[model samples]
Target chain A: MTSANSARRRKPFPVHILVFLAPAFIIYTLFMIYPLLDSLRLSLYAPDVNRQEVFVGLDNYERLMTNDLWQPRIEGAIKNNLVFFAIHMLVQNPIGLMLAALLSSQFIRGRAIYRTLIFTPTVLSVVLVGFIWRMILSPLWGISTDFLDLFGLAAYDKPWLGLEETALPTLSLISVWQWVGIPMMLFLAALISIPDELIEAARVDGATAWGVFWRIRFRLIMPTVGIVGVLTFVGNFNAFDLIYTTQKATAGPNYSTDILGTFFYRTFFGVQLQPGNPTMGATVAGVMFLIILAGVLLYMFGWQRRMLQVEF
Target chain B: MKKLLALAVILTLVVALVPATTQAQDKVTLTIESWRNDDIAFWNDVLIPAFNAHYPDIEVIFAPAAPTEYNAALNAKLEGGTAGDLITCRPFDLSLEHFNNGYLVSLNDLPGMEHFGPVARSAWITDDGSDVFCVPMASVIHGFIYNQSIFEELGLEEPATEPEFLELLDAIKADGTYAPLSMGTVDLWEAATMGYQNIGPNYWKGEEGRLGLIDGTIGYDENGFVEAFEALARWTPYLPDGYQAISYPDSQNLFTLGMAAIFPAGSWEIGVFRGQDPDFEMGAFKPPVPEGADTCYISDHVDIAMGVNAASQHQEEAMLFMEWMTTQEFAELYSNALPGFFTLSDHAITLEDPLAQEFLSWRDECESTIRSSYQILSRGEPNNETQLWEVSAQVLNGELTPQEAADIVQSGLEAWYEPQQQ
Candidate 1:
């Protein structure tokens, strides 16, 4: 060990580091970077009248941006995607934070059971979740009406999954329910890592429980909050399976529930009657990539300055 | 030079003939790829055994993928050069693209191609009508499947006109014993398929309106198309309570379980209805014509076909099987076994099931046409079929008026279809 260290004391250049990184680098490149670049390349070409692909020099993107056929669809998808992301930030994350804060309390009983129960839905497949929720909201089979009647709210028992106004929100809530566990677990980990002595010291300094949480515990866990937010931003933007599974490929009720992911899938793979358009599909995918990249960069540069971890 | 030429000719002949002779001597296996996983037993137990009795040397395998994944899976298999000798085709553009890519061989010169008429061959033929790729296997006719027991108990006769149809529906609703119509807008396609297309043929005059729309001679906002939407809108009151949330399966169950009196259906659903219960007798009736109209039209849509893979190693054996499919015996076997999928060939076969026979009898009673959005209109940005599904469902949901629904369809078409721009 001494000899190896002495050999590269001034310069830490080493062949072993490259060897160690080879597996991950090769995997990430082949699976992630290569296909992404290829898809980007594919987005630049369009099929002419002869059905042969030709280099169109951003004509595909131009059509997607300006043409009457795609402009509204893309706009609607972006608008819906914003709504989807907002729901996660506004509803999912806050509930997760509250659950974590409560579960972390010393006086709370059955913490493990509550934690496991909340986490169970996260482990279930999105397909199963969509199926179960669709049934639960279904007027014919679901107990939603009966359940509502118990609270004298039977008048509110309209089909949430079928109506245009409520369909997107219903799906969003289903997604939030399945995913709230993630942020809770993350916040819980960060909260437990907090030194008990520090909290005790704050109490000795005549701090209320609420004051200690806001000024001490929450301040210490700010980095986790940033991580949770960004994670949700990425996840919500890429969501397709739940909506697709619940509302078929057309995302019906006049496309009211369509988001960026379902829009891309419909454009790419098509449903019953329409055929796939690979070039245009690739263009949508490229736009998705840019949107995600811009978001990550924004979060990194503007949202948080430091990610100081609590180490003991 | 002459001697050398003769020797080269002899060598080439032997090389070609040797493989042919070797292949003929050994038993050959031909695998078929299909999306009809539901009919696996029908293919294996009835059709394969019958085919083997005639051609004992060739063994056949029936392989299928889930219907939803068939297109992507089939493309991957074809690209990898591992697709089966026989390929089951989805109608129109799906199979047409395969022919364009040289995945399927042009079966124009094949002997049994003459048995099919232009109407049957229209689905798998080239746009210019020079080449036919797939052998037309089956078509599903559109009509109404109703509960016979309920109809008998209510003393309701089959309605022959639109006014009578609505009157019967009113009577059923007044009775309060059963839901008048078993249909839903949740799946969207069910609305377009079983509701709009079922009744629209009488309003649009079928082929003329469909062609006019394609040529831009007819806009969807016109009387024919608008009236179709009006018909769908009219059905709103007769539908089951909470029909907006009811899915395709839910609608089917409502009829099958005797909760609903009538189900707008395709000929494809006959098998499912037959298996429900022995006591539940199902009845079929053609879509009622307009009040003053004399002629009636039906949507006899071509749904499935079979084609040979151009890259198959055993094209000769596969072509033999294709030739046999055109025979009368195969037609009788396929129609009786499948029940709902009426064989496309004009073999004058008898249907054993009363409901299927009744559905088939409408072909002679009405002029036959296909779904309006199927052919050339659906290849663009907002798929015409997909648009119809949305508008038709919304019309039933009361989200859009009939005129607004028609305008949405018309504009969606004009955005891409050139003739519609006028």
Candidate 2:
């Protein structure tokens, strides 16, 4: 120990700390925390014709789970969401990871050009992306069909964005196309950060390039994969703008594309026949929050700690 | 004596100048909300300019919303306490609830109340003859729009009777030139609108017909509504194949491209159709009411109205703007811009379109045409119209017989109101 360091450092005053934190704390409380708590309180009630709300704790929740009109809608939305997420995981992330690995490789050409082009869609507003896709897929426009005919798969051409069976999957593909860049960049950073010495050492030990990548590079990036998965799970559930901009509240031919967000919108504001019901709307919102919370908790407890926790 | 004279002069100046300055300061600003772009242009170009010229002190603002987003956005604004000073709405909106809550001022004794034509005024007035809750701006007549050139080419005259109409439809089909009517039922309401138009003539049969089905005095399974449904069902064979899968724009295209002889739609489409095909010779008539009825020509416009907001600080300014809106000048402005719509004002203007001219001439000769009941169903209660849509779709799909579909409508309405009872 150095004998010259004799003075002790004092802890900062609590008031000084509070002064530094107050503005952000106040803003967060007002906008986020209070509104969330208020919504949870509101979900316990039901609307009456007199514009008064009556308390009916958990009855809304119960009815949502079991009611004929509502239960099926909820189940359908969940299934659609899961399918949407799975497609992204299967198609988007793996493609992104491969591209990232290739881009990080020393021999790749025009890396900057590819990166710029791939990341361009991510910067666009979801509404613009939806409208652009809708126009491209329009039968009247015939661009999509014309493109497929070049590959001699003209017979396989479909009104993929319009039909009941293909609409949701097409929308998911669109979402994946827009968002793949985010994970690609994350993987690219992780890939690049691997020290050159480690790969050199493996190569000197008579390892092949593929062997070096699997043994050293892939293992080092397990933490990034975990982060990406959690990000994807959260994003899938919170999605509203793409579906809303494309489908409107009715969500197409027989409500095929209706999701929890549109459901909440219709219930809260009502449509041509149903009057607006705020409490029910709040209940839907509350349930959505709970669903997202449960997802995040699962990610933290099951995946994040296990994969990312480094052992010395 | 000189000092006292100066004080009196200063006092007189203060008294005279104070009110004029205050009145200038109190110049009220009022806003009107609507989703119709054309109507917004009319307000900006014609109504506002005229009103401002009349009352230079008052300022008027126009806030237009997109069509699909209008209702939901308006409701959110109302609930969130940010609605405009004057809201553009239809009669069937829950304005009655707003009136009961004292959000809407009673227009009973408002200046120019007596000028509101009966058809225009009937929607906003209370059933008990208490007060006028809204001011109607225009009346829309709903019926079949047919290509006149096509009918003429086939040597078919416009049908004036139900059997003649069926004959005319078959003749068009036999000619193989066109389908009878092109329709889309994807949204559920198109079929219901068609059903209402078909049922309108039967409505005047007193308590035995349409009224009984609606008010629950007689069950929907009653013979009259069943006949009405069957009448609607007759058109099914004439409709395009895969009609259920088609959207509104697709159906509109079918008609505009002359794929069908007729389209069961609102006269509002007269502008839209003409815009698409300037030479598309088209004419409309009340779908022939039954052979012998008290009111044979039954066609009415759905009500689109304007109201003063409850929270409006400038009620006088809003009312003044509304009063000018229903005047003859404003009426002609709207009529010239969008033909086939009759303004609320009693005065008339000459329409250049031969079909529009014919509609007006027919209305002039026939005074007792019953309005379309679809409009009533639209503004009445929620699910009432939706039930009609669902039942109509069921009827079209063959899952339910006509009478069963009627029963479903009745039961659906009953279920909707039952929650209120609890």
Candidate 3:
């Protein structure tokens, strides 16, 4: 009798709890969880004779890391991915930080207009963005040269998108243009959240405005900075859409811009020149997953501690 | 306990009801997955209306995905076992594997294959001749489309031989009014298609030569293909400035707007040129072969085709749609929309564009032998297009010597075929 009574009296979940959780749970599970789990399951098997997928243990990963045709692609992709991520960290984040600092200044007028204008690009679809930039940079149209010539920078311009040496970096800058707004908004939010009294206290101690910002505001926003850094790392590692849109899966100019995303796509779907190999694709995706996981772990364990502040 | 009971009931009911709801009966929908290139506007404005008028029972939906997206989405659907009932199969589509996977129906068994031309049937039929995977939708011919008005103004007669062609181009270039020829290399295949299609089979083995290529008797660097590339590379001096950076539409625009004298393209561009400049005096001609070459006709290959999904519930309706699509009555309807698209159905219809009509007449009058595009060759074997793509780009960029490119293609073929010899 006591057991039955205890079971019946167990903590009640209100009707609203079910109502609130049901929709989200169904969406997340159906869209995200199922596909993820299915992909993971598919990674375990390799296709064999009779075109049937048979269990192959870790052979797919082994072949991908050690095979002649595939090994170079994997190493090249990793090196290219690191280079891409580094460029974004050095160029994109700094530009975004500078823009945020400038926009958040107290004397800046029409801040809302500037913010909206800057954010508008990030809202555009990557395909539309790619086409727009392609047209602007086209030598056929000469719009980019004409526009640059008005500012007397015509000498600085070339067919930047077509050259092998400049293609990846040019694409990176284009990406930076589109995505800078996101980090800028993050920095802006963080900047606004810093207590003004801390800066005032620093100023009262004979600190200059720049010193006050550095000593107080910057320290307080270290957690936000760390978060932005981690976000950038994850985002760059998973980057596929922009490169796919601009360069196709091959990431052209003789594949000089072939990063991990393009490599994964080409392996997964196969192109005109190759047959689609699912095992190879899964291996590439698995490597990408490990890379992202590692970056996230570093942020969570190592950087998280450094960003922590204790109040006296 | 009550809350848990409610949660369990809700979950059970949802899972149970999902299957309980059968596909709504008496509903028939046919989706054609096509690209957003030349066919998009025509399908929307003309094809859909004509189709709907003929068969009110079935709704035709033009669900366009761009080329890359279309391929990926189609592959996923095929892999997921939910591909469209009618899908566009490009020249390089991996549909052979899709057919093997039981994704496509045997289109040969469909009701009306007798009406199609031999080339059309051959393009889509299985190698064993037991089944047809698709019905050729229309033919795409690759050749030089010239501005007739510009030629007339320059007093340049169409060249009848290789030397005559070179002399004409050199004269045009020397006059300084326009470049002799222009092509966009951004697509990577435009140059090769121009070179290979017209001359490949001639140098190859006539019809037997092509068969040899297929059966591995002839090698990839078969002297014929190399000869074609070498002849094509000589024209680089006459092409437009920054030719490598040019894209497809930009080249079309250049030809249409009189920025250039000639544009190399498939016959599909006739409608675009007509739309862009109705008064433009444009006509298509077969590119001249090198001196003493056996082939003279422009290569016209079967283009996009229709096929029924094997797994479709409405197989009968889908088959009916495909048969109806290829008839003379339907051909007339399509011709009314997209002029310059050729048909073997012998449709007696008035064309919208006179220039297109002239080109069609010329095609009919000239008994010149034609060949298939390189796409057809590469489609049968893996990495055919890849090797071709790289070599074409290298030839254009002058990065690879002609002999080197030939050796590369030969090695590529050996990698795929040599193992079979053992």
Candidate 4:
């Protein structure tokens, strides 16, 4: 009887744990891992003269890196993706952090209302956001121009989405506007989670309001910042819908706004007059996967190791 | 055991009668997938009724997708082995790719294929000329659709020569009353339609220029293509400010609303143009050629072609529908539905719309050779049409010279061809 009791106490290989996990595990494997592995496998082959898929083994990757037709587009897309991430980090995160700090203060009234209003845009569809912005900024409609005119800056109004020099930056800023709410909410949660005693102590020690944030609250929320940064990085690299909806698959006005996501889309699905090659498309996806994986690894090992957790 | 055996016999009898009952009904549904969502009314009001009247046993279902999304969706469906019985085939590389993949059923043995002219048939004929894959539906003539009132008000006649066209653009620019061209480069394909299709054939004429491209003997940087880009560049100044930001529909609005003088578009847009402005008087003209060119070439090609899916279970019914599409009744219905689209029927159909009549007049004149757009002639690797469109945009934006634009296209072509040669 003691042996049987001990055996029960030992967990009996935890078969029920697997039973609980089986559904989610099967779903994740079937939808996520299977498609990813299949795409990776597809990257090794290429279409021949007869349009038959023939195994070329790393040839698609080699061509993507070295071939004149694809290399420029791939490199340009990667460069744009980096810029996209950087803009979100520099402009979006800082602004979001500032907003969160302001909203999280004890003195601030109607904090819930402010939070709801700010977070509303994040819930709105990207397509709706893109269309609204496109119309607002349209040179033909004069909505943006009229708004600028109110501030005596009508001369500055140009086709911001059309010009090659301004297109990518304009698109980035638009994206930042829509998504800034996400980081704001995250930072707000992190700020609220911080023990109020630490901040009170900092204030009692003759620290300024700014000093409290800089010395206490900011440091405690570094983990959230790291999480937000990694999330932004992954999200920016995977972005396609906004640019596609607004600028199209060409990422046009001479592909000035072309990024990795749009590039991957074009390479995989193709657009007007261009035929899609699944192998090449898969190769682009694999490359993007590696790039995202590198960014994640860098965060996990490099940044995460250096980050010291603060205990209250 | 006796009861179980009796039940099994009854079940077998019921199962066996089901097929016979279905056969007695003799109902076969045929699905046709096409990009002509705008023609849904015609399909419902005309084609379906006519088809049902002739053969009530076969029911036709028209599955329409938007032009932009059709190819990719159809490709996915075909690859997954779940495509429609009758599939719409795009001209050029897409159709060729489908044929090469053995996804298309040959229409060579189908009756009424002879109604299609050699040019129409050529669009769907296999690379090896072994079989024709699709039935040609309609031929679209591409050129400039100009505001008749705007032209009259400005005293601008139809420019018959390249120099005259440039002169007319200058006059319109100087007048400053309206944009000389309603160009929507935001779509990108518009630039190709204007730069390559409307102009390239004027430079690259005859079998030598056409076949030379496939053989790589005639490069895009040659004088012919250079002149084409140069011509497109010359019109840049006359385009609306921020034309690159304009979408296709908005540009058409510009033309129809008299904000712009001209819209470079296909003949198929006539219906939409008329629908937009009932009283608007629009005139069609073939884009003029350079001074020394022997004959002007108009960009004309088969618009929508129908092909049977190789994996279709009901191909005979699908083929019957396709055969009926070639009949005079169907042709009249199509022409009546879409007024401006030219059909491939030996039986003459009268064009009622004045603008369509004007376009047909050009066809009857025979002074111009009808050529497929450069987009259709070129294969879809290194994406020549897209490359040309990009370069043209750059040229218009003053970032690249016309020569540089031509060179960029040539380089792209070389990149595509050199690898294939290896």
**What tens digits encode model 3's per-residue C-alpha lDDT throughout A1-312?**
999898878957578998999999999998788766666667778888676899888888887789655787788888878888888899888888788888878999999999999988999999998888878877677587889999999887766665667778878888888998998999999888777787777888899878866777677777878888999999899998887877777676556678888999888777754767776687788888888989999999898876665321
Question: Which residue pairs in candidate 2 collide?
Answer: A273-B382, A273-B383, B92-B379, B140-B301, B300-B372
- Which has the greatest DockQ? 1
Q: Model 2, residue A277: displacement in angstroms?
A: 1.7
Model 1, range A1-312, lDDT digits (tens) per residue?
998888779577888999999999999998789889988999999999998999998999999999888998899988988998999999999999999999999899999999999999999999999999988988777889999999999998988888888888888999999999999999999999899998999999999999999999998888889999999989988889999998988886678889989999998877778888989999999899999999999889876655543423
Quote the true-contact fraction of every model.
Answer: 0.64, 0.11, 0.18, 0.48
Write down the TM-score of every candidate: 0.91, 0.76, 0.78, 0.88
lDDT of each: 0.88, 0.70, 0.70, 0.80
TM-score per candidate for chain A alone: 0.94, 0.92, 0.89, 0.96
- Whole-model lDDT, model 4: 0.80
Candidate 4 per-residue lDDT over residues B1-422, each given as its tens digit: 23336545544654564454345346887778889998888888888999999999987778787876677567766776666788988775678779878999888888998887666676788766778898887777777889899899989999878998889888988999899988867777777766566766777773346556666677777867777788888878887877768777778777888899888877878988889878888897887879977677766656678899998878888888889988888877777678778775565776788887677566654333334224343565677777877887777777889899888777777765653233
* Candidate 3 per-residue lDDT over residues B1-422, each given as its tens digit: 23336545544543564343335456577767666565777787787777777787787767677665556566665665455678676543365556766888877666667777555565666666577687666665566678887899899887756678789889889888886787755556665665555545445534555556656676656576677677667777887766656666777777777878877666677877778887877766666655776544445566667677776767887888888876776777666566667654544555666655655554453322234323235542336666676677667666667778777776656555543232
Q: Candidate order by lDDT, highest to lowest?
A: 1, 4, 3, 2
Sort all candidates by DockQ, best to worst: 1, 4, 2, 3
Tens-digit lDDT string for candidate 4 (A175-229): 9999999999999999999988888888888999889999888998998899999
Cα lDDT tens digits, model 1, B226-308, are 99999889999999877887889888888999999999999988988777775678888899998899999998888888999
- The interface root mean square deviation of candidate 4 comes to 1.6
Candidate 4 local Cα displacement, residue A244, angstroms: 0.9
Q: How well is candidate 2 docked (DockQ)?
A: 0.25
- At residue A100, what lDDT does model 3 achieve? 86
